[model samples]
Target chain A: MSAVGGAAVPAVDERVTRVNPLRRAFTRPEMGAVAGAVAVWVFFAIVAGGNGFLTLRGTASYLEVAAELGILAVPVALLMIGGEFDLSIGSVIGAGSMTTALLAAQFGWNIWPALFVSLAVALALGAFNGTLVLRTGLPSFIVTLGTLFMVRGATIAITRITTGRTQVGNLDEVAGYDVARTLFASSIPVGPAALPISVVWWLALVGLGSWLLLRTRFGNWIFGVGGNTASARNVGVPVGTVKVILFMLTAAAAWLVATIQAVNFGGADVLRGSDREFFAIIAAVIGGNLLTGGYGSVVGAAFGALIVGMIQQGVVYAGIDADWVQFFLGAMLLIAVLVNRAIRSRAMGGRG
Target chain B: MSATVSSRVAAPAPPELAGTTPLLEVRDVSKSFGSVIALKDISMSVHAGEVMCLLGDNGAGKSTLIKILSGVHPASEGEYLVEGKPVRFGSPRDALDHGIATVYQDLAMIPLMSIARNFFLGSEPTRGVGPFRRFDLETADRTTRDEMAKMGILLRDTDQPVGTLSGGERQCVAIARAVYFGAKVLILDEPTAALGVKEAGVVLRYIAQARARGLGVIFITHNVHHAYPIGDRFTLLNRGRSYGTFAKDDVTREEVVTMMAGGEELEELGHELEEFARADGLAAGRLGEVGRELEAEARG
Candidate 1:
């Protein structure tokens, strides 16, 4: 429809027909993730029927597991789309939980102050990861990987050195413990099911993350920097600052999850959230996020966490071996990426 | 502003154009990287509502000169003037603050983003305040479509990703975006170099459109045919130095091509190559094949 070739150009109005709303929706990057979630849910419902896996109580169990991972997965998805990775989030959780435990139990501090210290430690870990990556121009994958082991070691060593055991206990006896538990660990009752408070937190975080990703200038800059860093610089985007802020957001989510778990259990296991970093990344990949970055959705990552949660609990309910969950998740990641690429290609007129 | 542009070839430079100062003027500008001098003693001026074509052979420091003008690199020596006043640019943003915009060959656009999004990449239109501020998609789409139409680029869907557009269309979008953003002096880096015949024609028409809109345009190209039609003034660069600047009324298209191709030196090299081929038995047949291909290209 260029004026240079106006001879056979179709009428402008004819070319301007409204695109089908449903087709447009289907073309979104998250569609594959959504469809996969539905498929897995249906499959689990059929396989685990009469075994209580589809029951309200069973649903709450899976949702609780999903909520813990979803809180981390949403920000992880954002980080991935911004072209970086934070492998230290799992260790940040352990670090946060241990900080809360040591400060409250060993140091005789109030639980509220202890929680603040834990949050501060988590933020520091995130800032360290972000600054190192930006300043040294090293890959975040390598930088956060180093911090991952360092934080894990520090959490274990500090806990064992102060407390008699690797685990810190007796958190419930601390002052203001009841308020902390009420805010983070308490569950809400509905009919025959008890929904964990983390689920509500997860939903809130998802809403906020989605809003930040889709509705703001920062979101546009995230996509721009991730897609083409040189071009983003040419256009005057503060790429490093956007990346640092995203890293902090991921760390904050980790602290939230750790707070929820430590309060609910009234203790800290030095090895808490072990290997969950890989799980969070898997969830992001399954949510249709590219490992190479520049494309993804917060909603898709949430669905990916749901899939993981279902498979994690559904395997036990169906009497299947628990070890198969890892294999299924690994396979799901590959399948979702392929499915997303195919849909993207078709929607983008075969540019995939 | 529109008074300076006329559809006829070799139209006299407008009275206001001659009366007012040039928007951008460079005097004896030179750039060097380490021991190598990329550009030397290059001087040029671009007036508003004028298309100044920069003609050069490969490795003739055309890119270096454009970079200096667009603020990607500072001139190693000499003065850069804007609006009859001297100015030093620290970055592209500094130049942009003075209403100077550069459309690089890469376009600095994200292909995965929509046209409206890329149109307003760093300077997005937003409403609300603080955390509540949001990208104004409605206004963006409307402005993008409206501005492109003004440049005679009628994209049916402004929401479409820029990757799906043809090369010519993308150039037009870049031009339209620059104009809409209040660019007084626009620099395009080899806009037609990678395009097809029809596509290049489309880009040329938009350059004319930008000229008609009264923006001072610096169109960088090595192709004389592309430069001659719309160029009011031509500055030929060879071996890191300016050969001369010529108005359209002063130079012929063939003369520009001959000078750009290094004139008699190129003919001497061709003759030497032909002689070398004839002097060797094995090279004669291979050179004949190359000669045939070159002849075919010329015929096409």
Candidate 2:
């Protein structure tokens, strides 16, 4: 290829062949997640025999849970790849649901306007977290952890003050509720099963996020900043902008999941998304994203969410104690991390 | 002695290229941070198709000069010029806009990124429009391979992480990246300090190659041997001021080495060592015998 834009003279080195295709395949970061997802699916299918655990109905059940978790996991993966964390994502979801509920049910606003205001608030909080991190030069983990408590407390206090309760309901009676519910929370029928609309949203987000991380300039900036912030800035990568935008993206995803749940159930409780941020992070880690940052795949994170979702319901189908879900999830997380580390080393051509 | 040294240090320019304007010139520029002056009245000029060797020990204002030239810091006094036109740069990006790129000693490349990705880090080539616009991966991979090959660095795969590359290869990649981005003046900081003998040779060859490609190169280093082979002009700095710039034709490698070492300082150090040894020789102990032997070896 000739140099584009008269940039540089192209040289004459034409040795373009993969040294070992098999090795390359095993080295990909997503391989571990793909394997983990398959393993969980099979294990559940075998233990829950005759329970239709492998059927379309059973698949939909797990997929719905996976879809909700996946929605947040994909963006959280991106944020981690950009070398930041958002502990505030779970709180953002609760706040979003509360904002929509408070606005539509208490303030008597239209559902559409209330939804918009909720998403805007989520975006603003994300920006606040980003700005605080950047301006203070503090770790995002600490900043977002602080936002987590602040948003959670505010959500609880506001709901209690206005509605005299920790929960808001009767959202279906609000204006434009029908349209919002149909668009965001309605399910579609498949052969032998009905699927949640959130599942479709999750898959769409996964595809979009994967394309973004693998194919875009902004994606490169995300990797660059995470890998080496000083080097990235020296090359004029606009590290601060990329990071803030990632923070906002995670918040937006949380808001979307919150809207789907609020519309689907017709109400929201204050504790709707408690401890879910850790689940999202677990999925991302299982997906091969380094906790240290700079490396990951959104597709891998989707599979990670699927594994969590499978175990969440699979334990029940297999007649195991419900509390075993946490135990299994913790074990899966550990295995995924170790397996991902191995794949990463192999991807670096097996260097330490 | 001064007159003899001046005559010996007079550089002769090739007749055809004598009158061209330098690509970058710092005219008596001075920089100070608070009460501390980092550099003062330092003047140097680099022409296209020539490598300007900036030689200095640590804390000798080399970094300050580089920062000023690359627009990381503005000169506290005097003029910084590009193509004979005086300019003040607000940021490194502004300096880059004027075609001056600084390849720092740290290389400014993300080690975890792929070769193609690192090659096109800031100014990525994109195809399509709007949301469909993506990093032109095929082009990026191809161009990265080809440009690196042009610098005599042939990688097995452009998709390989840059961290896997050797130090020499990494430096070459940084140089090639700067050149690909249309850097008219490429300033490299200590490009060979951390390299082996063979790797140092490789970097020196590329410095000369960059000059041959019509780019003005400022190769900063403390190693005289590394600089002596590739540099067209040598400017030595001591305590934040230039001794003087001398063309390759006018200065001997021996003179450059002695100047770099500071002859009087070496003599003073030798005398101090002798006095220390003599004072220790008067001590009547086993430790005194070891000191005498070291002193004898020094004298010998």
Candidate 3:
């Protein structure tokens, strides 16, 4: 209602109303992550003994593995936040690696060209997945699942047909191996500890993803699409386009991760990158991303990857069976998801 | 009475013959889905600086006409004119490109995104060169705040997600966006349907503000109460056919309500109520009370 007698309008008055401090705290994701991070450190330190787990070398090892997984998780988290998924990313990694090896080993292509071809192939595959999901109006999960199997089958068939083996090698001959290794595989030593280049890539990607999600239009579209697609459409957003781009971005990250693995190991396995979709999804969920869409953080996702990476190395450091990693990861995924849901429900004033 | 007189005296010259033509004109448009005819020869015109309310009951083809105008579906037959030139839109984008924007009841905003980001989702301003074209955050925040302020929404912060805003604030933001983007014709679909009385008034004021800025506004609603005061012209629809389109001076609120409920339905309902009252042995003088109840039921 309009105000009378020069009285301030109630709507205007409400705008100036002081927000409840509790409500303000509940609205932010950063506060929750900081608390989670502290809890994680405390838990790991207690389990591994103060000196063993908190050592620089132990931290570097965790950072190394987390960085590699974190790079993929960032884009995967973003895609999830945008209300979509890219199950085919695991296959894209194998596809990228195989392409790189095929170009360099079989065709005598330079490393730069091989890597370029690999990335281009990955982008094309991503575009295909995006287009199919958009055109068919199918769920991204189903569409990318189809692409996942199709690309995996294609990768295995091609690798066996060309090399008469289940694996591709001789990528070392590529002209850009030295540069690739330096960027993706090389390590930086600080005093007695060394940090892998992949860790740096992971950190940079996390930073970029965080900025894009919080401060950019693309980030807004992600939240919009995830929150309510119908509502997003009413507001003039190109919902289909945003979804397609997110799928492509996730695939691109997969390509980057595969490149690092290929260079680091000096070969590609037909079964390489298996179950990475689950890992990336779990990491994202653990990091505070809602599986139903609309809310998430890149830092949270990276931290999720850190948790997984730490558990992986922590098992060996504690002299426990390495095979138990999968069991722990599975349990952690469920617990993290439950925790995330609980936190989200609480944040939304317990409506759920 | 004095307010009505003031409004009349304050009315500017028609301005219909000025440089700008009516932004959107629907000339006897009709549509049918399979066996059901949704809209039958509905003719309406929207000029800049005026509010044209499309009033109808359920099944009156209000949704059908809006779908046609907003490019959700094409009219089965009849002409849609833009700038006095005939045209047909294949999709929502086509309508948008023609400077027509549709704000549906749901508002189409992403609740998880900040207000500034939702305001410029698709057409974000960018800084930097190729391969590094970053979003222009400062511009988006400043413009979103300024535009909302102009529309009488003084947001506490542009950084808050749209979901945090009240229903009325969201509608205002959508309208401000459409206006800011240079929409000549603005079609609002049941914007106040889900809002409370106060929130509905907030949206209505913004609608008036939009009209004042010289944008043709098509305000669709089922509530005659909401339509009567703000609407300059009213078009009534019933079962896919136009009852009539009248200027504000030509019809009263009661007539519009009566028209929406077809004459036959009203008569039938009245007869049923009288018979029931007689059968129940109500006093003769209580007939007026019975008649009023029948009228209310018929209107509803």
**Chain B TM-scores across candidates:** 0.86, 0.87, 0.86
| Top-down lDDT ranking | 2, 1, 3
Q: Which sequence of candidate numbers ranks them by TM-score, best first?
A: 2, 1, 3
* Tens-digit lDDT string for candidate 1 (B33-145): 99999998988889998999999989999989988998878999999999999999987778887888888878556777778878888788899988799988778877887
The DockQ figures for the candidates are 0.31, 0.42, 0.27
Q: Write the per-residue lDDT of candidate 3 for residues A16-46, one digit (tens) a residue.
A: 5555767666556534544555676677778
Span of ten consecutive residues with least summed lDDT in model 1 chain B: B1-10
Each prediction's TM-score versus the true structure: 0.89, 0.90, 0.87
Q: What tens digits encode model 2's per-residue C-alpha lDDT throughout A1-352? A: 2223123434334544435666767777788999899889889889985687888888899999999999999999999999999999999999999899989988899999999999999999999998899999999999999999999999999889888999999888999999998889998998889998999899999999998988999999999988888778777788889989999999999999999989988888888899889999999999989888888889999999999999999998899999999999999999999999888887775553
Q: Model 2 TM-score?
A: 0.90
Q: Give the clash count for model 3.
A: 6
**Which regions of candidate 3 are displaced past 4 Å?**
A1-26, A173-176, A342-352, B1-20, B32-36, B273-292, B296-300
Kindly list the per-residue Cα lDDT of model 3 for residues B164-213, writing each as its tens digit. 77777788888888898889989998989889999999899988888888
Clashing pairs in 1: none
What does candidate 1's lDDT look like per residue over A140-218, in tens digits?
Answer: 9999999999999998987888776889889989999999998999999976999999999999988988888877888
Question: Positional deviation of A200 in candidate 3, in angstroms?
Answer: 1.4
- Greater lDDT among 2 and 3 belongs to 2
lDDT of 2 at A37: 92
Please tell me how candidate 3 rates in CAPRI terms: acceptable
Find the candidate with the highest TM-score and give its number.
2
Candidate 2, B-chain TM = 0.87
